[model samples]
Structure formats: structure tokens, C-alpha cells
Target: MTHELGHAVHEYVSKKYGELGREKSCAQAETASIFAEQLVFAALLKAETDSKHRFILLAKHIEEMIAKTYRQIAFYRFEDMAHIERTNGEVSAQRLQEMFKSVMDNYLGPSVDTTGVEFICAGIHHFFEYDYYVYSYCFSCCVVNSLYEVYKSGTVANFAEKCMDMLTDSGVENYCSALAKFGIDATSPTFWQDGMRLFEQELSELETLEADIMKRTYINLEKKATH
Candidate 1:
């Protein structure tokens, strides 16, 4: 519901662009949705005082971000591998499964069993048809997280206004142009570096909070046992 509202807000802001506005890149299409959800998430995180509740919210948000960003990009690997195989001949279904399992193991790590990766990969229609489209999720995740960091850091003045301006120009501009006003170069390697840094920061906060919560729990249990 909240996610869809993000899309709706984007549509409303971009409607004036007419056909041009409606025709956006897949990554740009997802940016607003992720941005809006993160806005809501940040707000909820600020108000929550309970450690256990905060952990759950933080964990869920981080996990979903990973699934949306890393997992989706991992899926994009399948598209790349399949296309290369197509140069010689049609890739067999079994071969596609092999490629998917291989990629899955790389991302999921060696400890986890990926026994039926084929069945999981089969559920994604884009696996066979979309070519190289899944990268949009990764693209959006990076852009939104970077933009969110800017908002959090106060690096840019009047950011909300700038963000609104960018969204308004959605029909007329690509992400590179849209982000230029903020001094954000979507083409630069630093763009990805900044994004990963934000992710690492979030993960560090989660780790800190988890440690504090566990220590408090231990203290409480010790006090009760002594009593």
C-alpha cells in the first residue's frame, strides 16, 4: 500500500510531462517508489523507542533493501549469461538452470544449499525474456539510497525543493540530468561507492543496536537471578 503510494506520488508529479513524462527508464520508474518507502521508514525509525521493535523494523527494511538491490542485480547476471550463450545456439533449459544455480551459490554463499534453484529461477518470467532489465532495481536502490543520504546529511540546501524539481522534470530528463542539479554524478564510480557506504553505515547501526540490546538483556537476567 505504501509502496504503491510512492508510485502514485511520482505519477502525479510527472503527469504534466505527457507522453515524455510517462516514458521513463525502468530505474527511474523505481526510484520514487523506493524513495517514498524510505521516507516513511526513516520517520517510523525516528519515533520508535523500543529496542526490540526498532530491531525488527530495521532488520526488515535492511533485508528488503538487500532483496531488492542485491538479489535483483544477482538475477540480472542470469540475463547476461543467457545472452552470451545465445550467440552460439539456443541455451537449453537445463543449462539455464545450471547458470542460475551457479550465480545463486555465488551470492548466497557456499554454506547454503541451493538444491532447487531452478524452481526458484523459473518463477521469474524475466529470466527467460527480459534481456537486461533487472538492473533497474539495483540502479534505483543506489540512486535512492544516495539521495536519501544527501537528505540525511544536509549536504544540499533546499533538498526537498530540488527533489521536487527533479521529479517534475522526469519526462524531459534522464537520471543523469535529473541528478546533476544536486551535484550527483550518476556516471561516476564514486556514486556506487557512496551508496555502498550508506549501506555499510546502516548495517553498522544495526550491529551497534543489537549489541546494546543483548547487553541490556543479559544485565536484566543477571539482576533477576541475583534477586
Candidate 2:
């Protein structure tokens, strides 16, 4: 649903501004899609009444954020390292696997058993087919997150229309120029942090929910035992 909205917005915008360029256009579309997903997720969380269901939703949101942001950043770093190593000398398959494992472990952390996961890199077609493709996920997530913050601030009176206008202009103007109209400065150092803050907030909420759910479960178990 989110991706399609991105396409639709892209199409709608492109008609007005013309094709900006492949990379910028794709980035703009991705930004729209990710923003849509965040909005929908927020709406769903708000509507959910059951604690267990809300916890599930929150968990899924956190998982998705981690995958899109941290994991993709890890992949980007791994690719950078691999490319640099290739330039220095021949990187053996074993060495590549080791590099992949190191980066994966960095992102996945100690709790995630990454045993036998190194080989999985061989299956990732993007590593071969697309150059730095993983970074796009990170880029889009950050852009959308910053834009979503603007929307939530209630400062922009016509947020939807402004977004549409931004999309329309994206086809002609560069992403930074187009986003600037909506007061989003992608080049700012804080821009990425603005995006990351959304995930942090979601993770914090999820942690609280998990603790509450565990407490309720413990209470129920104790009640049953006593009865």
C-alpha cells in the first residue's frame, strides 16, 4: 500500500515537474512510500485496543525500523569495505564471508545468533547487481522520517497538499530543492537524527508495552495458581 502510494505520488508529481533524474526520482518515491507506511502504522497503533495486539504492532514497527535503518546501514558499510578491499587486493570468498559476518554481527548484536549466516551474503543479488542499493533503504527511511516530523508539528497547515506539491516539484528540482519548499533540509546534520528519533520513540513505546504485557501475564498466572 505504501509503495503504491509512492508510485502514485511519483506519477502525479512527475506529470507536473517532468523527470528530475532516476536517482532523485526514486529517492522521492521511496520517501513518500516510507512516510505512508509510518502514518499507517501510527494509525493502526492508535486504533488498537488490546494490549497484546498493540504490543505485537509495536514490535513489528520496531523490527521494520531496525531492518530498514540499522541493518541496511550495516549492509552499506559492508559493501563499502568490500569494495575498498577489492581495490587493495583480491578478496577471497572466505574473506568476503568473514567481512559480511563481521558487519552483520555489528548490527545484529550479540543476542542474535549469526552462526552460519555469512553464507547468506552470497544469495543477496543486490550485492552484485546493484551498487550501493542498500543505502537507498536508509536514505528513504531518514527522509520520510524527517518529513513526517514536519507533518506532525502542525505547523504546516496543508501538509498533504504541500507533500503533493513537493512531489510535483521533485521531477524538476533536485530532492534537496524540492524538500526545501516544505522546510525539510536533507543536508542538515540533524536531518538524519530527526528521522532516527521516530524510531527511538517507537522503540521506547514498545519496551514499555512489552514490560506491561509481561506484568499482566505474570499477574494472570499467579491468580490462576492461587485459585
**Most TM-score-accurate candidate:** 1
Worst 10 residues of 1 by lDDT: 125-134
Q: Per-residue CA lDDT of candidate 2, range 1-227, in tens?
A: 77688667667655753444323545666777787788888899899999889989988888888888888889988899999999989999999999999999988889999999899889888899988888887899888888888888888788898787776666566778777876878789988888889888888888888899899999999999999
The runs of at least 3 residues in candidate 2 whose Cα sits more than 4 Å from the true structure, single-residue gaps closed, are: 17-25
Q: What TM-score would every model get versus the actual structure? A: 0.92, 0.89
| Root-mean-square deviation of every model | 1.8, 2.2
The numbered model that scores best in lDDT is 1
Counting clashing residue pairs in each candidate, in order, gives 1, 0
Per-residue error (Å), model 1, residue 127: 3.0
